[model samples]
Target: MSDLAILKRRHALLGEKAPLFYEEPVHIVRGEGVWLYGPNDEKYLDGYNNVPTVGHCHPHVVDALAKQAGKLNVHTRYLNEEILNYGERLTATMDDSLSRAFFVCTGSEANELAIRIARCATGGMGIIGSDATYHGNTSTVMELATNRKMGGPKRKKSNVRSVPFPQMYRAPKGMSEGALAQAYAAEIQAAIDDFEKRGIKFAGMLVCPIFANEGLPDVPLGYFELMQQIVHGAGGVIIFDEVQSGFGRTGSMWGYENTGIVPDIVTMGKPMGNGHPLAGVVCRPELGDAFHAESTYFNTFGGNPVSCAVGNAVLDVLEQEQLVEQAAEVSAYLRSGLDLLKNDFDLIGDIRNNGMFFAVELVKNRKKKKASKKKPLRIVNMMKEKGVLISSIGADRNILKIRPPLPFTTDHADIVLEKLTECLIEVEG
Candidate 1:
């Protein structure tokens, strides 16, 4: 059967919930480092994906998986040294107060459990999330993911609130950088006030330190600190959804580190196991105590031996390879290159990046007017046809998201730039 037919068959068997990106999809046969090989043996430079936090199929992670799978892969019901060690090492990377780890199989699960813990601990019903922020796909988290169209109605009206995202490029009039930060904080405070008037205290504020999927917009300096103060003052916990920005993706061990604030809870995934199915929530010990006292939570395969081993190996490889430092160094280089591109391209409006996470916002006529999403989508498809892989996002899909793995090098960036330039030229023409 053809690949399309096979995919259709599989989707049918899996039910109609499966989503397809495009009608016709290139069949990726293999991946190594930052390159993906198509069925026709076409080599595509990966420039817009980072789920493989390390390069795709890093040998260290592969070897660890093989070794652990051969030895043991038991569930969490059984005590295992690998689980204990992995948990300790992972939590050790965070603040001392965040000493407890609750493992799960995906970012969605981690966020779902984190919300439960927060609500239980705070004894409050309301949760606040940023506008255009995506947390996860689980039912509970879906409510918090204001970016998804389906989330609006699924969200419980009384229990959820959304504050405007702090996109500096699109800040309100007269909003200076300092004032923008203050206004964003004030928005959160106002949300708390609204909830208080309704007799609904807040459980927590869920945020991404550097908002991903919302155009890779970085929170203004002092934003999180001020938000934390507001949440704390209102007796609400602060939960950092680091599912995309964690594990050194933001030039730090954790994204919250860059914000200079320790969140009450943090949900991490995607890069934690370097593509392996592992995610976790680390919380202040006191919160953990309260959560555990209220309810027993368990995931059958969350911290299984194999998953723990893979998680540990990812950490080992990150440190041994100094990939975090590499992200920091390469990010600077990429940003400089993007800055140059912005200077040259009139269509490029704004460039925002953190560590390896970079975004290029395209504009229509260079007067800072919003660019049509259709143009960026066309550019992305053109780039893919040119043997380069990148993706477009933003509320309008006008921002090109360029988040390659940590192992992506300067040379890789140059290749991506060349291909991107070709696509841009074609689109411009």
Candidate 2:
């Protein structure tokens, strides 16, 4: 058999009954600043992945990981200065109320831990989330992340409800932005009412400041404030899942900072260790106290010394390089480029962005518009063929998710725009 055929057969055997997102996937062998290289050493511009917040294999992060591993890679049981120092640095960037930190290895675990803390702090069973907002893959968070239809089975007794995402692209007609914000906030209030009707108290609301996986739905201004009031009045905590949008990816220290609301608990990851396995949940001291009193939560490798050291180094690099500011500046440039492209291409329906995080929605028809999932899949694959890497997302997988590392530059933006323009033209034709 041919090499390709053998590889395909092996894949089928490994996933005997599993469903895959793509029929054919590229074999990436290495990555660096804003680029991924295939097994054949072909360079692909990375316009989608954000887990490498700073850049793939950043020198500072690599060095820190190596140094810590050589010195001591112990767990939380042993008192370590690296964990303490990293926690202090991370919490310093958060709101004053969020003065405590609990480390985890991935965004999913961080969010799971955050939900546990929220439930304990409020002593409530009901939880709420925005429609199409992805928190994590764990059972509790999966229950809260009900935007996607494929997100597992519904929780029969888990008092989790979903509110409509505050998407300006599909907002109600004739509604002002402020009015739309209020309307979206009302959805949460309605959820609270439903909870009360069911004799269930409100636990908390989980939100993604930019709604990463659902589409880069920028939360309308004042929306966070209104929702905060509603959740707080209903005796529920607020959790911001900044997993994909944190660590300067949104051009700020944190995504919630752009929303101008201070959440009771904020879970962050992906970029915490610049591609290293590290994540954390920072919460209000009161919530942390409640969580501690409720249960002794610990992970074997959550706050290991190596992860802490790498995380600390990531923070240093972010500050010294001013990558957050770079994201802000380059985001404006990239958005403008996308806007110009939208004018040239009718299929490009919406351009939504926050900092370096952005998405371009591909639509089938401008008039009875609907997401063109097939078109995006084709475009993503075509772009990959053209030496650019991007991904498709949204409820229908029609939105092109454009999130690169903070180190992405104007030159990189130009390359992405050029390749995307070509892909759109070919697809449109």
Candidate 3:
């Protein structure tokens, strides 16, 4: 079918608001390694998807998934050794305190479970999230979604509070990094205090440790440490939503490892099963026990045998191929290349990265640090025209988000860099 016909059918069946990439979306039919193929055999370098973290259609993950599906596929209630073994191996990568796991089919469900655990353990309804961030789509978790684009609650829920995410690029003039960290941490404390004043008990703060949705900002130093103390002192848990920053995307196994603070509960998604629907929450034993005691939680397809096999296989690929270390090395190379581009392009404002994930902020005026909202989307579409795929993020949607599969190498980075340089020149002209 033609693109227009497909689009018409999509709009009619799935509603007009369903999101698609670029002004003209690609009709991707096949994906392998770091590339996606269209119907005419035209291939585009995949540079924006973390869902296939180990690379799309990796033989290892696909084989494991197929083999397990052929043998058995059952929910968590069944006696399943695959689930137990996978769970044990997965949590072993985390801090000792985070030794328990709860499986779910999507990030939304994982985050919902994390919120439930926090509220159950702390006896509170108050939760804190970043002012420009998205956690999930579930009605309960959507209350924490303050991103206007996500269509969160029209009115701010009294139980939910948002704090300005810390970003060094836009720090108030003359404020030291140390002071900025304290000021950001104070925002959390203020939220907690307000919750108390409003007679709402404090539950916890949930955010991506790397602040991926907040333009991957260079966070202020000592911010999370102070936030940790403030939250714990207020008798609340710390929940790190690692849906975008987990499974070696951040060089470390978990996003929380990069931050000084150790989250009480960590939620992971997307990359866990390498395109399979697998996501879960890892928390302290006490929190898991408390949540389970209070409510019986069960998911039909979460941690099914096939999902566990795929999850285990993804870990196998990560370890055998050493993708985590490769991410660190390739990201360093990409960072240096991006620095060279920054010198050549006046549109470049700030570049921030965590391992393989990168965000390049565009600016109309570097001196004033004005966000170039239109240029980012235009550049993204232009890069798509050049056989490369990327996207835009941030509250103003002026930050280029370049996050590809784990198999993406220095060579792939070079292609992205080359295409990006050309696009910037055209956009500037």
* Best candidate according to lDDT: 3
lDDT of 2 by residue, 265-346 (tens): 9998888888788999999998999999989988999989999999999999899999999999999999999999989998
Write down the lDDT of every candidate, Cα atoms only.
0.85, 0.86, 0.93
True-vs-predicted CA distance for residue 317, candidate 2, Å = 1.3
TM per candidate: 0.95, 0.96, 0.99
Candidate 3, RMSD to the unseen true structure: 0.9
TM-score: model 2 vs. ground truth: 0.96
Q: In model 3, what are the clashing residue pairs, if there are any? A: none
For every model shown, the clashing-pair count is 0, 1, 0
Q: How accurate is candidate 1 locally (lDDT)?
A: 0.85
- Model 2 worst lDDT window (10 residues): 15-24
Query: Per-residue alpha-carbon lDDT of model 1 for 247-340, expressed as tens digits?
Result: 9898888988888899999999898888898999999988998899999998998999999999999999889999999999999998898898
lDDT of 3 by residue, 145-230 (tens): 77666766653446889999998999999999999999999999999989898889999999999999888999999999998999
Q: What is the lDDT of residue 112 in candidate 3?
A: 93
Model 2 residue 204 lDDT?
A: 93
For model 2, the superposed segments whose C-alpha errors exceed 4 Å read 1-6, 9-13, 16-23, 147-149, 155-157
